[model samples]
Target: MEEGATETPEELLAKQHRKEKKDLQAKIQSLKNAVPKNDKKRRKQLTEDIAKLEAELNQKHEEELKQLKSPADTKVGEMINGVEAMTVEGGDQQEVKQPRVTKAQKRRDKKAAQEKERESRIAEAEVQNLLGERHQEGLKLAQKLAQRQLQIREISSDGHCMYRAVEDQLVQRAVPGLTLVLKELRSRTAEYMRNHADDFVPFLTNPNTGDMYTADEFEKYCSDVEHTAAWGGQLELRALTHVLQLPIEVIQADSPTIKIGEEYDSEPITLVYMLHAYGLGEHYNSVERLKDPANEEDS
Candidate 1:
């Protein structure tokens, strides 16, 4: 009758069964005590009542146990079984299966892959074009400026260098290369003297014998010559300036307002053309002269 003091049907049933069992047990004990004092009828009634209560209790317990072990409780086990079936042979067969791509998606992927390959090819071609133009231009300029042709040689396993017509020119230009050459020559000389005194000094005396040392030794002596030729950089800077027909400072310095004819000042289209020509060793800042016949007469 108290508020919120309600027992559910299952709770009430359990409570009733407990009370009945307790009462039957008490009655049976009393009957046993009386049986020793000649109360036969009371003992028989109590025994019947106890047996009936016990039967009811057994039936109720069996029903409760059945409810506890019902089909709903086996759902987790069923789910596990299903998963094992899928992995081994059942639960999520579709999930275990490979995903299928749509025809439209496949087409799109193919198109994208093709586009990427095409762009890669175009980029490679552009770099090759630049290198080809530069090689040709260097060859032309070597003849014009050095009066000696330039030969592009792979002097190492992977490195490249432009030699002035002949390998001996490396020795002539060795004075201008760099401190790297100086340090290396000194190091090699020291190492050589330590290892073979007679062979090294005599080797140093012979200009060709210097070449007997590895490319690494020869490189340091050559670096200073190249550096001096550009004043501070390399012949490339000189070559670039000469090719662009611009002053050394214009190319070397950073400027906000680009001069049209100078390396930094040209229009975007002109810059591209100059880049191409500069690589080719024929840097021209303007295509305007080509467009204008009158400009040719003025030239």
Candidate 2:
């Protein structure tokens, strides 16, 4: 016999079904033989697994039967419609076949898809360009202040960028492996907001609707910030300052310098701000590090 032969789709499907059924049956039998008779929970689970596997095997058997009954020459669509025979007894009627697609239509579709992909890439590049420009501007300011060159260490821009950025800073400050600790910071911030609702609620406002957050809305927002991968905002930043007991200074290219948290006599970790666009609008970029020649070699 030939070592390898091309199998039709039906043959491949049948082989897959047989292998799956065999494996499932073996698993069920093994479970039945090993599970303790006195353990009702284990026995019940084994029984359920067996029943499920048997039902799947029966369904596969039915499908295989249908495949075997289908005529070899019949079109795939006709076979799917349960047409076992392609011709009538006298061959008086003929089944009409679908018209083949034109080369021009296929070419046009391929061109349109490519054009859409190109446009998407172009838009992404434009956004990255904007961010890069803003980042350079911040570096220039830092360099001017220190009278030396500076470099940026970027953080992941997922909604958790702020937390991750703080994590990076903390790691640099000798608190290594702070990933899980940073995640819990969200919960701590939420707890603080809940306790001091009066202090923060008045400042909370919906950016889209231009309305101050209601008590219920603010509660839901805090919940999302705590439990979900919601984007961190100004309130979370303030909370983080308190939680870490470190002052945060935001350096933006287009805005005045802003400081959050308790006043510190010492220099605080400066985070460069970059603009990131999501869909149609834009949001602030999370913490980015600045390094001069002194730290560049170590970095």
Predicted structure with the largest lDDT when compared to the true one: 2
Q: For residues 2-96, could you state the per-residue lDDT of candidate 1 as single tens digits?
A: 65234443454466557856865765564354332222333355467557656755665554444435433322223323342232333233434
TM-score quality measure for candidate 2: 0.46
Poorest lDDT segment (10 consecutive residues) of candidate 2: 276-285
Runs off by more than 4 Å, candidate 2? 1-150, 175-180, 206-211, 264-267, 276-299
Candidate 2 displacement at residue 177 in angstroms: 11
User: How do the residues 73-104 of candidate 2 rate in per-residue lDDT, one tens digit apiece?
Assistant: 23333434444334445655566664464665
Q: Give the TM-scores of the predictions, in the order they appear.
A: 0.19, 0.46
- lDDT of candidate 1? 0.36
What is the TM-score of candidate 1?
0.19
In order, the Cα lDDT scores of the candidates are 0.36, 0.60
